[model samples]
Target: MAATTAVQTKKKKDRTFVTTMKRLLKNKLAIFGLIIILLQVVMAIAAPVITIHSPFKQNLAQSELPLFSEGHFLGTDNFGRDLWSRIVYGARISLLVGITAVGLGLAGGVTLGLIAGYYRRLDGIIMRIVDLLFAFPGILLAMLIIAVLGTSLVNVAIAISIWSIPTCARIVRGSVLSVKKQEYVQAMKSLGASDFRILVKHILPNCSAPIIVFATMRMATAILSTASLSYLGLGAQPPTPEWGAMISQGQDFMWTSPHMTIVPGIAIMLIVFAFNVVGDGLRDALDPNMNLNQ
Candidate 1:
């Protein structure tokens, strides 16, 4: 009877924790954001299947076709490329940039943050560098990097990753500082656990919540940044179906076929907005103090 009671008590605690998490997810705005994010992901994945026109194929005769015209649903650009098709393909560039840049930033930042947080003497030096990077606006820093590296997809990713690093590092460092002072960490030290083991097992797991939230937010920023770079001719080159490049290519035809520019612009706005909403929701959902109403 005693053993059964103990098992039931443990299960109850676990259920309570899960219920709390569910309550956080119950926020309608967060749920909506999640849905939109998922929808975008699906659209990106299904881009090829959804569109018949190759994003690169151009029809000068049908140039600047407006929405709902002829065969083109969203219309055609100055180059007569299908707007809908271009937008679908553009998703690949945006997702690629967002994921790659954030992944690089997260990996580098977390590693540096852990090292600095664990070693008291190194903290000051590492944080100073982060602070210096943070002083400049991320966009401006990306611009500078792009200018120096020259216009290319790889350069855009690198520039955005550079801007992302400081913020990610700061977040991870703060989380690590908090976790390092915990009793478990102290116990680990007393047990003569290796530094790597303590950091990987005891510290990193507890710091994940904040890191995840930051990463989500950074993804939105990365997408926007990539677009901005492409707008400036520093990203995915001509004939490539990138949203920013599409907008740039369509600008001249804006007076004739506004849908050319407007469609791609809307796509960028929607993607960035969706990501921001989802990121905000994730932050709220991950808050430990939140409770689900029964």
Candidate 2:
């Protein structure tokens, strides 16, 4: 009997997974976004083999070459650095900063969020701290953190993560508040389950959808913030092949070498747009009320 029950439970879980996947697949925008993300990831990973020229290599004599100029398909920057190569390589830093910072923020934010939502006594204090962080603009907060921590790729990632943490915490706390009152959670409480068990086993699982959606959306935000900081000389430094820094360097020569500005700017926009649409699709798919299937 117990074996039959276990088998049935497994089947049910598998069915639920299948259903969720089906829903996601039905979302055209989500599929489009997924493709964009996958392409960027591939581009980032295969940067060296695919890049036309060494992103850091200088060719002062060939500087500001126009687009579609023989070997330089995307042209060269003001420093004669290959714009195509830099853009391709720049994907690495942008995606890395986005994914790493979001992952870090998820960790700290999940902990604080779970604690604040589950523990009444700590909720106010934690949320107040979150509020304080939010009072400053998100990018401003990131810049402030970068200013204090000084600049580098890792420090930039840390700064972005710190900025992201409060947002994550607030999203999770709201989701948790709704989840904790669910029937199973109350049943767990009534059956003498510890708060930790109820939270970890019941509450958090139910909150996963919103957390996932929020995380996806925040990745784009983090990327933009990282790029902005890099542009402002507070993130990746010179010759780093970072998109924002590339834009910063290109801005001065925008008239003669517009490709320098346009290429990187387009890259950032495509990434952010992809993630935003994916987040929207996920939100729609996850919400039972919104039918993705026509």
Candidate 3:
């Protein structure tokens, strides 16, 4: 009976923590961004059902039509591809690239950062390499990488991941440094806990909040970087409904059909904005000193 009561009490405490988190995340800007991001996800998932025309199917007669034409609502592009369909499908490309690149960076950076932070002797060598990568602007670094790897979806993802690694590693190192000084971590060290056990069981868990917030922010940056690469003809090759590729295709006809460029541009802006808002919200919500009821 005592064990059951204790288990229930622990569960209640966890639920309280989750509820407090939800209350903090109710910030208007954050909620609005979450809604917009959710809508885009749904639109991407329902692309086929949402659009009447195929994203790649062309109709020369309907080419360059304006928004709200007789049949097309968002109109057609230079190749007579449906603007709405292309935009809907393009969400998939942006989201996939953002998530995949950030996931790769998070995996590699966190491992390296934890090791470098826990081992002082390794810090200098690891950080110097990070600094070297950081010397160039992220977009330029990605461009150079893509140029070497040759343009392709996989190559673009790899480039973005590489560019993202240094930032993630730096953020994780900062978090780990703060966590290592906590009394609990020191107490574990005094008890003769193995370095690996202390780090994995004590330090890393405490430092996860900042790492999560940074990852969310990095996702937005990754998306923009991938788009830039695609714009330069290094990602999501022709006939693919990538937002950046769509923008590149529409650039030549910017005067005649501004919607082609503007629509995709808007999509990219909204997605990046959504991620930034969510990241900011998470940072605030995860702060232990923050009082939601106040």
Task: Compare the candidates by TM-score and give the number of the best one.
Answer: 2
TM-score of 3: 0.91
CA-only RMSD, every prediction = 3.1, 2.0, 2.8
Tens-digit lDDT track of model 1 for 1-294: 979967996897588667746764676776676777787788889998998999989899988888998789898888788888888889888998899999998988999899888898999999999989989998899889888989898889988988888888888888898889998789889989999999997799888888888888888889988988898788989988998988887788777777877888988888787778867776776676653435
lDDT (CA) per prediction:
0.85, 0.88, 0.86
Candidate 2, residue 115: Cα displacement in angstroms equals 0.8
Angstrom error of the Cα, residue 92, model 1: value is 0.9
Residue 100 lDDT in candidate 1: 94
* Regions of model 2 farther than 4 Å from truth: 1-9, 291-294
1-294: candidate 3 lDDT, tens digit per residue? 979967996897587569657865678898888888899889988888988889889999789999998778998997788888888989988888888999998888888789888888999999999999999998888889888989898888888898888888898888888789888788879989999999787788777888888888988898888788888898999899998988998999999999989999999999999999988988888776674454
Q: Tell me the spans in candidate 1 whose CA falls farther than 4 Å from its real position.
A: 1-17, 291-294
Residue 227 in candidate 3 has what lDDT?
81
Which candidate, 1 or 3, has the higher TM-score?
1
Best-to-worst lDDT order = 2, 3, 1
